[model samples]
Target: MDLRQLRYFVAVAETRHFGRAAERLHMAQSPLSQAIRQLESQVGATLFERTTRRVDLTPAGTSLLEDARRILAGVEDARRRVEQVAAGTEGVVTVGATDLAAYRLLPRLA
Candidate 1:
C-alpha cells in the first residue's frame, strides 16, 4: 500500500524470515510481523508462504517483488538526481581570456 509497507515486504521477501528482517530493519519482531500482516491485508493476498521451517513466496509475491524493486530503485534514482542538481548549484564559474576575441565573446555573453 505505502512505501514503508513495500519496504517491509521486500525485506521479508529477501530474508525469508520475519525475525531476521526485523533485526536488519532495527525494529522489533512483533511490529515487523504486524506490518507484514497489514500489508497482506491491504493487498488482499498472501505474499509469502510461511511455516515453522521456512518462508517462501507465492506467485503473487513473485510478481510484486519485481514491481517493488523497480519502484524503490526509481525513487532512489530520482532522489540522487535531485541531490546532484542541488549540489551543482553551490558553486561559481570563471573564465579567462588573453586575447581581444575572447574578451569580446565574454562581453557578448554578459
Candidate 2:
C-alpha cells in the first residue's frame, strides 16, 4: 500500500524466504512478516504461497511484482533527480549576456 510496504514486499518476493529477506533487509523477521501480512490485507490478495522451507509468489503476487518493481524504480529515479538538483548537479541554468559576452565568455567558460 505504501512505499515501505512495497519495499518489504519486494524484499520478500525476491528472496522467497522470510528469514533471508529479513536478513537482506537488515531487520528482524517478525516485523518483516507482519509488514507482508499488512500488505496482503491492504491489497486484498494472497501474495505468496508459503511452505516450511520456501516461499513462492501466487498469481496475484506475480502481477504485483512487475508493478512494484516499476514503481520502486520510478521513486528511486525521482529521489536521485531531486537530490541532484538540490546538490546543484542537475537541472537547467539560464544566463544572460550580450552578444559579445556570449560569443567570448561563454565559449571560454564552456
Candidate that would win on lDDT: 2
lDDT of 2 by residue, 14-59 (tens): 9999999999999999999999999999999999999998899999
The parts of candidate 1 lying over 4 Å away from their true place are 89-103, 106-110
Candidate 2 lDDT score at position 72: 98
Where does candidate 1 clash, by residue pair?
none
Candidate 2 Cα lDDT to native: 0.95
Q: For candidate 1, which ten residues in a row score worst on lDDT?
A: 89-98
Candidate 2 residue runs with Cα over 4 Å from true position? 98-110
